[model samples]
Target chain A: MIMQTIDLEADGLRALNATLHAQKDDTNQTSWEVVNAKGSHAIAVGLDAPIEVTVRGSTGYYCGGMNKQATINVQGSAGPGVGENMMSGTIVVEGDASQYAGATGHGGLLVVKGNASSRCGISMKGIDIVVHGNIGHMSAFMAQSGNLVVCGDAGDALGDSLYEARIFVRGEVKSLGADCIEKEMRPEHLEILRDLLERAGADAKPEEFRRYGSARQLYNFDVDNAGAY
Target chain B: MCGIVGLFLKDKSLEPKLGEMLTEMLVTMTDRGPDSAGIAVYGADAAGQGKLTVQSDDAERDFASLAEDLGTAIDAKVSLYQKDTHAVLVAPADKLDQMRQALRELRGNVRVMSAGDTIEIYKEVGLPKDVAARFEISKMGGSHGIGHTRMATESAVTTMGAHPFSTGPDQCLVHNGSLSNHNSLRRKLRREGIRIETENDTEVGAAYLTWKMQHGSTLGQALESSLEDLDGFFTFVVGTKDGFGVVRDPIACKPAVMAETDQYVAFGTEYRALANLPGIETARVWEPEPATVYFWNH
Candidate 1:
């Protein structure tokens, strides 16, 4: 139950993250509380723990990489690759996040209060992402499997080149991915989105939201449509 | 999260098979909905008149038990269309009258529409093709039709909450978006026993229009009313026996592309999705006007 609170000034938070990474071997479930984290990069990398890391300000790229059983929390917006290649555990952001917040993550959850930039959850394998704000283009690009929940708007080319993943967007979207199509809007989605929004502390009503997903058009390949998305 | 496709090919003579075409299309969009898969096909041989096609959960349950259960509440054939989570009942062409009685029977909102001889719907934990294949639904040769895909969230992955819901009679709909005022509407729709099968904003949306149809309003009139009454972001494609309607929410955050060619018309979440559908030339592509509902009939 030991807690470590680090406040980064104009200097980089790399040293602190390195310190946290070094502490990953410890048995204790340490809580890292970071303050004044302005656009810091690689804040928490190569950490495997039953511990928790919290970033209180804006963060830069690859905030949480190669994660294994560790939990990271960002109080504000995060730059790209917030939880890239995370094997397990959870990462929560209280505000909007930048691009690639959870790129190539294989497991766990990434919760964001605001919108995300391009490739927000690109190439995700088994991660569960819940975003309260809008998401930029190419989210879940080439994703293999996972769940992505967006409570706000979505930019163009959402879920492009996706595979076996489940995505729920409560707001508007500029476009859908290639090989994506419209399906029926059924009741199951309302209840699911309702629960997700409630869990994320979003204000949008589950019933008011319509469901947008894959059209199941490209499960197998065809020669005539090889060039198509 | 999933995608779905259903076709009731009324014309048996159409070459290349409508069922195969729809299934292929469904399979092509697996990336849009890929949790699970199913599809339903009703050939011309199974065709019947004055029917309401429902593609919902409990496909195994016999239509007799379902119809008998609601025998006293509503006046419609609850049998015939049963595929997993979907059920298509053939009701009176006057969508409003049947809807009023339906409201008094079910506990939850049923995504309902009235249009023609065929009502197509598919939904589930997987992609659109999976849902369509579940019920052997291969083709829909009616004058018009409806379809949908799903990405799960607050609800469970089940057949009941799938798309292309029929509001009795010959009407059906496919939706993309959410309703900000769904709870308020659900209360009103359920007050009369219109038992909602699932807990989706789409059910509420369908119910809103079903209520209007039940109260002696034409499909177009009902959609016009909904333009003012409903809240949230959405784009909808509705179909009937003779024609269809398309509408967008007042604040269209969802993407719905509109395409028209000399032979056919289509819409999808992304232009790329419809890259090869019918007259898919770049010049015919267009985005739907936000917050406006337009209907087409032959």
Candidate 2:
């Protein structure tokens, strides 16, 4: 595998993304290193190749967003909207993540080795997120379909107004939102949690976690509650 | 959206570089807000001396001989240092009130930016880099500082609308979001005799903190109360004589990132503003939680 080193400060973000987007499925440049990331937004975004990019330092907003078949790793903390709307790829953050991590994604895997800020995995669609540390408030709000696994504590209003999404928590939840309640973990959920934990390098056991999902109350449209709308 | 940057130094060795570091951080946020910019620096204080930062659109006519007139009116020795459209008057510490009153009577058009023993505020309607250059902020030295780049969501683009609004002696506030109930709150605060100068929402925020502090609440306590009192979104970074504090609203739609090291404590709307700070790679960085008050004092 050939390796490419791109200096972000010298090459510019547009040129770097263009280079990554130009690669085809059988391209020999499979590995890329980004130096001097320095909290710039939209690094390696909109990539459809199966290349691997490693950011050398902390990044600003939307790092590795809308990724497809790419494996991007951040060596430091990530700003807001990391891996947003990603499709069939993996993003790993060694440090903490800012707000709305993996928001509105259709399919992918995002692993945060450190804590995730508020609105983590909000409105997620089919993305699997594993946080080794705690998650902030309103995580997975209005989530249509996904699996959000937390190895640490969860903040307020976890998984509010969800639809068919599964949430697993290994620590105490501060408070649950309307219509979101804990459900009994079955064998299938345990199996899914075990696989996600192992893949994300989390040390917690699947049995130590609890599952929470929507109570399906908000989905009904009743004539009696029309004024509340 | 607006941008906010604050630096509070724990090590004395970093004191002289405070302004330079803060200027760099403020300029990096130009993309967040490009309409106006302002900075507040808490510099060294001399015994028995207080500093009054005043601004005037007509610097040539208003600032000249204004110090002599103020000194004569207050019957105290005074010295003036002018920068861009603002000037700092160093006068007797006990006579700050009289000087402020006398200046009001002497030059009705002059605006008092800040009045305290250690604080000097410089702000204007320009890009952050241009504003910092006009004030020579990089050359100035301070113990701690806070800066803002305004995008003008709630108010007009004017010198008075720029952030780092100083409502109390040695206290300044920079805001990133707007307040929904500022009009009603402004009326109430004015009924209680708090001075609010503009229709700007952030001025009301600064005045509210001043009102709370006047009623014997600490800065942290005042900030904690603001979460309940002030409505709409806000992420505020406040600078006082001895401390720097940050507070975000309950929703926390506005962003704020904080970094703390043994040498200093830094706050920015994003990590990009803090990328150039010394030892930042090793600093403990995280986003400030919602409706929480984080403060550091020297």
The DockQ leader among the candidates is: 2
> What CAPRI grade goes to candidate 2?
high
Q: After superposition, how far is residue B43 of candidate 1 from its true place, in Å?
A: 8.3
The numbered model that scores best in TM-score is 2
Model 1 ranges off by over 4 Å? A1-229, B1-17, B36-48, B54-116, B120-124, B192-194
Please give, for every candidate in the order listed, the TM-score of chain B alone compared with the true chain B.
Answer: 0.71, 0.98
- Write candidate 2's Cα lDDT for B201-282 as tens digits: 9999999999999999988899999998999999999888998888999999899999999999999999999999999999
With a 3 Å backbone cut-off (N, CA, C), the pairs that clash in candidate 2 are none
Give the lDDT of residue A166 in candidate 1. 71
* Best-performing candidate as measured by lDDT: 2
Give per-residue lDDT, candidate 2, residue A172: 93
- iRMS, candidate 2, in Å: value is 0.6
Tens-digit lDDT string for candidate 1 (B154-226): 3555655556556544566666666778887888789966756668777777777788888899888888788
